[model samples]
Target chain A: MSLAKRIIPCLDVNAGRVVKGINFLGLKDAGDPVEIAKRYDEQGADEVTFLDITASSEDRGLILPIIEQVSSQVFIPLTVGGGVRQVEDIRTLLNVGADKVSINTAAILNPQLIFEASQKFGSQCIVVAIDAKRAATPSGYGVFTHGGRKETGLDAVEWALSCYQLGAGELLITSMDRDGTKSGFDLELTKKISESVGIPIIASGGVGSLQDLVDGIKLGGADAVLAASIFHYGEYTVREAKTYLRDHGVEVRL
Target chain B: MSEIVIVDYGMGNLRSVEKALQQVAPLQSIKVTSDPQLIRTADRVVFPGQGAMPDCMRELKQLGLTEVLLEVANNKPFLGICLGLQMLFEHSEEGNTHALGVFKGDVVRFNEAQLFDECGSRLKIPHMGWNQVEQSMEHPLWKSISNQSRFYFVHSYYVREKEAIASGISRYPESFTCAVARDNIFAVQFHPEKSAASGLTLLENFVQWKP
Candidate 1:
C-alpha cells in the first residue's frame, strides 16, 4: 500500500499547559498536554506536535516536564517546537522523548542552526517551521518572526528551498493569513512549496472541515495536514477525519 | 508480570517503546537501560533504533552492550523496531558502518529515481506515514491484528533479505523488506506504538509471547 497522508493535531503549550486560540491570539487553556496527547493517540492521530508559546523571558526549560509527561502517556510520534534556540534544546527534547523539534525564529536568526541541528541529530528529527504571511507585493509570501509580528522580507518559497538544502528533513509551513479562518488551507502557498522541495511539506493553518483536510492533500499536495481548532474543540475526531479522507480516496490509515 | 528491558544505547528516545509496552501490557515491568547485566536477565528484550546507523553503532559499542544484546536476542523474546530492525543487519550504506551482524544483509538507502508510482508520481523518501502491511508468513505477533493492517513507518533505508525470512511486507513504489521473523526474534520497519489499535494489539501479543 502507498504511504497514507498523515493527520497531525498540534498542541500549543504555554506555562506547562496546552493552549489554543484563533489566529494565535486570545489563548485559552485546553487540557493537560499528556491527557490531550493520549486522547489523540487513541483517536488515531498520525503524529502530534507541541508548540510552546511561553515567553522567552520566562525560563524556556518549563516545557521539558510537559514533554516527559506527554511522552510517557502517548505512544506515537511526538514533535516539540516554539522556542528551541539551540542544539541543546533539541537534545533535551529528544532525550526526554520528543521525536523532532521545530525551529522558526532560531532558524531565521541563525540560518546555520538548521544545518548544525540536523548534523547533530539526523535530518529526520529536524523540522524547520516557516511562518509566512502574504507579502505586500502582488504575488509572493514573506517570512515572519516573533510570532508573525515582524516581517523578514524573505520569500516563503525561496526560504523553504534553502531550509531543505540545509538538511531540514521536513518543512512545516503555516499560512498566517489562512490561520484560524476555518475557511481552508492556503493551497496555493502549500502547492508552490511542495512542488519546489524534494522533502515532505506539512501544510498547516486553516482546516475547518474534513473536505479542507482532503483538499490539503489533493490540491495542496501536502504530505501531512496539521489542524488545531477542529480536533481540539471537539469539532471532529481524528478518526472522523481519517475516515472521511479514506472515503474520498485520499488513502488515510483507517 | 515479567521484566521487559528496552536496551537504550542513547541513539534516540526509547520512551515511546517503553510507554507503548506499558500500555499494551500494563502488568509487565518495563525498563529502558543499557546495563548489560539487566538485559541478560530480562524476560523480554526490546531493541529500539533511531537516528543514523553510524551513530547508533558507535553508542551501542561505546556503551558495551553488544555481547549482552546478542545473548538476549538469541535466547530471549526480542522485538526490534525501525532502526532496531536495520541495526541487526550486517552493514548499512548510511555511513558505511558495520552493524551487529545478527542478520546477514545490508541496509541501503532508497534511490529516488526508482521510486516512481504507476502513475509516475514520485513518492517521498523516509517513507514517513502509515501504510498497509501484508503478512508474508504466519506469526504470533500478528495475533488479533488484521492481515493488511496499516502501520506507521519513518525511514529512508530498508533491509534487503529473502522474502522467505520476512514475516510481513509492504511497498512504497516497490516491495522491500518491511518485517523479519525467526524463532524468538521479530522485527518490523513500522512503529507499533504509532500504528494505533492493531499496533497495540501486536505489542500485546509480543508481551504474552513465549518464544
Candidate 2:
C-alpha cells in the first residue's frame, strides 16, 4: 500500500536562527531553529529539514551542535542540507542523527559526488537538491546553484533524472521563481520531475495555504511537500496540514 | 495522588504529551519511562505516537513493553493518541504493518472518490485542524467536553465505524470515526493537548478517570 505523503517544515538557518524570504530576498528572523523544530514536531510534522543557507557560501561545516541539540530533543526523522558538499560532511551529519543529507551546488559542480556518496552510504542517505527558475529560452527551466544566484545552463528536469541515475534516492526541487511567494508551488516543475523519476520528490517553494499543499501532492505528483512561510507565521500547524492532505486522499502519517 | 506513566518508545511526541498532561492535571504526577517494569507498575499508561507504525511496533517489541502494554490494556487505564491510537488496531494499510490487534479491522485510507464532490472539489489530507468531536458514548474521559468543542486532528488514515470497537465521529468532508474505546483502552484521533484548553480538560478527565 502507498504511504501517505509527508508535510515537512523547512527551516532556513542563518547564524543559528530560522529565516525566510521571497526568491531568497527580504530575509526575516523566524525564530530559533530548536524552538521552531520542537513546535513542528509537536504539531505532527512527518520530518524536519534544516538548510544552512549561509554556511554553504562560507565553505564551513553545518552547525552540528544545533543539529545534535535538536535531534536529541526531537524524535522524528531529520534531514540536513546547505554546505553538505563532501562525503565526510554526510558522515558527520548522519553520525549526529541526521537521517539524510541534501546537496545542490556540490552536485552540480561534481556530479560524481552524488554517486560516490550514495555508493558509500546507500541511496536513502543521499538527497540531490535542485533549485530552478523559469528559463529565459523556450528549452526548459534554468537550474540555479549556490543558493539560487548562479544559473547553470542545464535543464532542471534533466538534472533530476541524472541524479536518480547516479543513485540519489530522493530529489528536493525548489522553484526560485516561487520561493517564499506563498502564491502556490511550481506545479509544472514538480509534475515534470515526479512523472519523469521513480524516486520520491519533495516540492518546495510558494505554499500559501492548505490547498497549496494538497495541490502539490495531487496535481504536482509530489511525494512530499516542504514549506516555510505559512508554517513559520502560524497560518496553519503541521498537524492541520497533514489532516487536510488525508481528507483530500493523500496517504500521510497522522 | 493520580500517577500516569507515558511509555517512551523513542518514536513519537513524548514531551508534548507530558506537557499537556501536566497542564490538565496540575497536581497529578506524570512520568515518561522506557523501562518495562515501571510501565507494568504504573497506575495508568499512555502511548503517544508519530512516524511509521512498523517502526513503533518494532521498538515496543524490542523494549519488551508489548506484553506489559497488552496486559495493562486488559485490566488498567490506557490511552492512545494519534498514531498511538492507530497502533491499537488489528493492522494498518501503511507498509502492511500489523498493530497491537486490541481493536478489530485495519486502518485504511479514506475513499478517494468521496474525497471530492462530483464537481471535483476535494477535502485536504492529513486532516489537520481544530474540528468537533461527536461523542458516541458519555464516556467519563470526555467529561466537561461539549459537542461543539473542537479538538486538533492530524491523521491521514482513520478507523471506519464498522470495524471500530467504540467510535466518536468527526467531519471534514464527511463524518468519520475520530475516537475509539474498548473496555479500559481509549484512543483519540485528535490531539487534546494541542487543542488548547479543551484538550487539557480531556487529559485531566483521563487522569481523573478511575476504572
Candidate 3:
C-alpha cells in the first residue's frame, strides 16, 4: 500500500560475463549475466544493476549483448553503468533494453552531458553515480572518478545538488572508503547527499550485513540500497535482505 | 493472430514493452511504430510513454498521432502505461501541458509536504521501485493478478480524478489513483512489463482477453 524501499542487486559484469566471484548454490553458470539477473528477479529484487567493470573501451561493447539477453528474460528495471561516457552509449544501452544508464566519470568531466542526455532520453532513465571518498572538504567528502582512483576536489554534496539541477533523475552515491571493506555504508555521506537532492538516492558501496540495508533507508535516508559481493557471493539473497528490511519495518516489497 | 501495435512517439523504452509482449505472445504480431497506418490496422494498441508531457504531446502532434490515438483508444482494447495514462486525461501539471482529454481528469505532481509515511520519514520523489497496487475494481487485466500485487513504478506525477474511472490505486503516503479503466481503455501508472511475474500474467490476460 506504500512505496516500498528498494533493494537492488548489483552485478559487476566484466567483458559480457558477470564477475565478482559469485558462488551461488545450484547456479550452473556463475558468469552468465542473464541467468544471474533472472535469479535476482526471482528473489523479488526491486531492480537489478549491471555495472560493467570491463576496463577497455573495445571490451565495453561486450556488455551490450549481455544486457540485451538479460532485459529479455528478466522482467525488471535493468540499470547499466560503468564505461557510460557519451550520449551515444546511453542511446545504445537503451536500444538494447537498459531501463536506465548510470553516468559517473562522464558526468564529472562534462556536466553538460547529464543535461543533454536527460533532455533527450528523459531524466527517468538518467542516473548520476557519484563515487565519494572521505576528504578534508567542508562537506567532509570529495567526488572521485575513474573508479575511485582520482579525486575531483569537488565537494560530494554540492556535486550531488548540481547533478540533480542538471536533470539527473536519481543519484547512485557510493562510498569509496567503505566499498569492498564490508564494514558498512557511509551513512553520513549518504545522508548528506540524500538530503541535498530532491530526487531519489541509492546508497551503495559497503553493505556487510542486512542491517546495513535497513540503515541505508532508516538512517542514511536513501530510497534504495545497492550491494555487490553480498548478493553476488550468495552470502545473502535479495529476498533475505528484503525480509530483513521488512522485519526492521522498512516497508519492503517482501 | 491479432496484430498488437505499440504507439511510439519517440519517448520512453518501447523495446522492453515489445520484448515483454513477444515473451507472452511469441506468435502474435506485435509492431512498434509511429505510422498511423500500422496502428490503425492493428487489433490492439498499447500507448506507452515517459518524459515530460509537453514533449510527448508535441511529438504526438508532430507525428499526427493525436487523433489516431484517440480513435484507437475509443474503439480498440487500449493499454496505457505511465505517461500514457497521464496523457489520457485532459491536462497535466507536468510542463503545464494539455493532454488528449480522453478521460475527465488532470495529472498532478505529488505534494512535497504530504510525502511523509506514518513513521514520519520523508518519501522520495519519482516514487521509484516496487509498490503494492490495490485493485479498486475488477477488470479483464486483473483476471489472473492478485488484489495487492507489487508493481514496478517510476513517476513523479499521478492522476487526480473522480472515482468512477479509477481501477487501481497505490500509495506513496496516501491513496492515489494509479490505474484507470473505462470501456475499451485500461491505463496504469506502473510498468507491467517491469513488474515481474504478476505483471507478465496481466499482460498475458490482456493478450487473451476478448473484450
Candidate 4:
C-alpha cells in the first residue's frame, strides 16, 4: 500500500477569477485559475480543485471557460465545485474536462443527487464537499449550505457517512470555522469525520503552512489536505509543501 | 505520423489521456472517437475508461463498438487504463456485469471487512493516489522506468488472473495486479496519464513500441 497522500491547492474563483478570503468572508482577487493550477501541476500537486464561491448565490453555472482553460493546461485531475446542482450540471462539467464535480447545498436539498451523479458517472468522480462548522448544539458541528450561510441542523459526521453510503467516492470536509484562518486545518473536525467515513477524506480549510498539511494526514487521518489562502497568497509553494511533508515521513509526490 | 485513436465510449475522462498523448508525441495523429473503422485501423489504440463496468459495457454495446474494440485489442498495439483493464475480464462484481472477456480474469471489490493488517494500518478503498508498482516481469512498457516506480491510481475494484499475465504488482491492502501485458495488448489499473513524468515515459514507449 504505497498510495502517497495527496497535496491539493484549491482556487476559490468568483466571476471567473480566483479569489482569496479569510474564513470564507471578505473576498479578494488572487490570480487566474489556470495559471495557478498549471503552476501547481509543475510543482507536482496530486490534484487541483476550483470552488466557484459566488455561482450559487448568483444563480448561474460557474465559469466553464475558466475550467476549460485550467483542464487543458493542467495534466493532473481537476475537481470543480460550487453551483453544481444536478446530474446534467455534472455532465456538462465533465464534458468540459472537469474530472469531478462537487455538490454542497444541492446534495443537502436532494441527497439523491449524489447517488444519481455517482451512478451516472462513477463513484470515483463524485466528491461530496461538506462545509461544516462547530455548532453550539449537542451535535457539536453543523453542516453549512449555500456557501456557508445557511445551516442544516444535521450532524456533520453523520452527513458524511450518509453521503459515502449514497455513493460519494470521497469527501472534501471543509471546516468553515477554520476556513481562511490559516490556524491550520481544524484537526479535531477533520479527525472526527475521517474516523467516521471509509471514503477518502480531503481535509480542507485553515491550512497556513506545510506542517498543517502533515498534521491533516498524521493527526487527522486525512487522505489528502487542501488549502486556499496559503497556496493562493504565495506564502508557500506546492513544491515546498510536498517537500516538507516528504521530509516528515509523509509520502508525497516530489 | 502514426494514427492513435483513444476509444471514447462516453465512460471516463479522455481529455487528460488525449492531452498526455499529445504532449509526449506531438506529431502523432490522436483522435477521441467511437468510430469503428478509425479505432480498428489505428496504429495504436488507447482504451482508457473510468466509471462502472456495466455502464462501460452498455455504452460499448450501445455504440456498437464491442466487436470493433475487441478486434483492435487483439490485433493492434493497445493500452487499457483502469476500468479499461477491468472490462477485459470475464466479469466484475461491480454492477454484476459480464465483461469483454479478452483476458481470463474477474474483478472483485476491495475486501473491507478486514481492511487492516496486524499493525493496524487500515487500507482505504478506491485506492486513490500514487503507489509503488513493482515490476512483475520485463516488458517494453517498463523501459526507461524503474521497477518500483509509482503510478497514480483510483479504483475500488481490481483484476485477478490465474496466469502470470500481470507484469506489474502493487500492494493496496494486499498484492494485486497493477499491470498486465501480452502480445500486442497491455492494460493497467492505474492512470498513466496522471502519473507524472514516469507515466509520460511509458506512453512514449508505447508510441514507439513495435510489439
Top lDDT prediction, candidate number: 3
Per-residue error for A114 in candidate 3, Å, reads 1.2
Candidate 1 scores a C-alpha RMSD against the true structure in Å of 3.2
Q: Give candidate 1 regions above 4 Å deviation.
A: A21-30, A136-139
Tens digits of per-residue lDDT, candidate 4, B39-81, equal: 9789999999988888899999999999998888888999999
Interface RMSD of 4: 1.7
DockQ of each: 0.61, 0.04, 0.83, 0.65
lDDT (10s digit) by residue, model 4, range A1-254: 46788988887778876767322112232365666677778878898898887745553455788877776666777899888888988988887878878888899999999989988888888999999999864558889976578889988988999999999989999999888788888888888888787889999888877888999998898999987777666678788888999899888767
- Residues B1-211 of candidate 1: C-alpha lDDT, one tens digit per residue: 6999998888766777877788878877899888999999899999988888999999988999888888888999999999999998998999999988888888999997787666555577767888889999899999888898888888899999733578888888778889999989999998897677788898999998988
Q: Which stretches of candidate 3 lie over 4 Å from their true place?
A: none
lDDT (CA) per prediction: 0.86, 0.76, 0.91, 0.85
Across residues A1-254, which tens digit of lDDT does each residue of candidate 1 receive?
57888999998888886777422112243456776787788778989999888886376778898888877777678889988888988888988879889999899889999999987778888999998888963348889887678998888989998999998989999999888899999999999888888788899988889999999998898999999899888878899999999999888776
Tell me the tens digit of each residue's lDDT in model 2 across A1-254: 12346788888877665666312212243366677777788777767899887654543444677787776566555789988778888888876667678998889999999998876665655888999889973437879976578888888988988998997878999999898688999999998887777667889988889999999988998878998878776677788888888898766655
Q: Which residue pairs collide in model 1, if any?
A: none
TM-score of each: 0.92, 0.60, 0.98, 0.93
Give DockQ: model 2: 0.04
Better of 1 and 4 by DockQ: 4
Q: What is the interface RMSD of each candidate, in Å?
A: 1.7, 10.1, 1.1, 1.7
| Chain B, per-candidate TM-score | 0.97, 0.92, 0.98, 0.98
- Candidate maximizing TM-score: 3
Between 2 and 4, whose TM-score is larger? 4
Off by over 4 Å in 4: A21-30, A55-62, A136-138, B117-121
TM-score of chain A of each: 0.93, 0.90, 0.98, 0.91
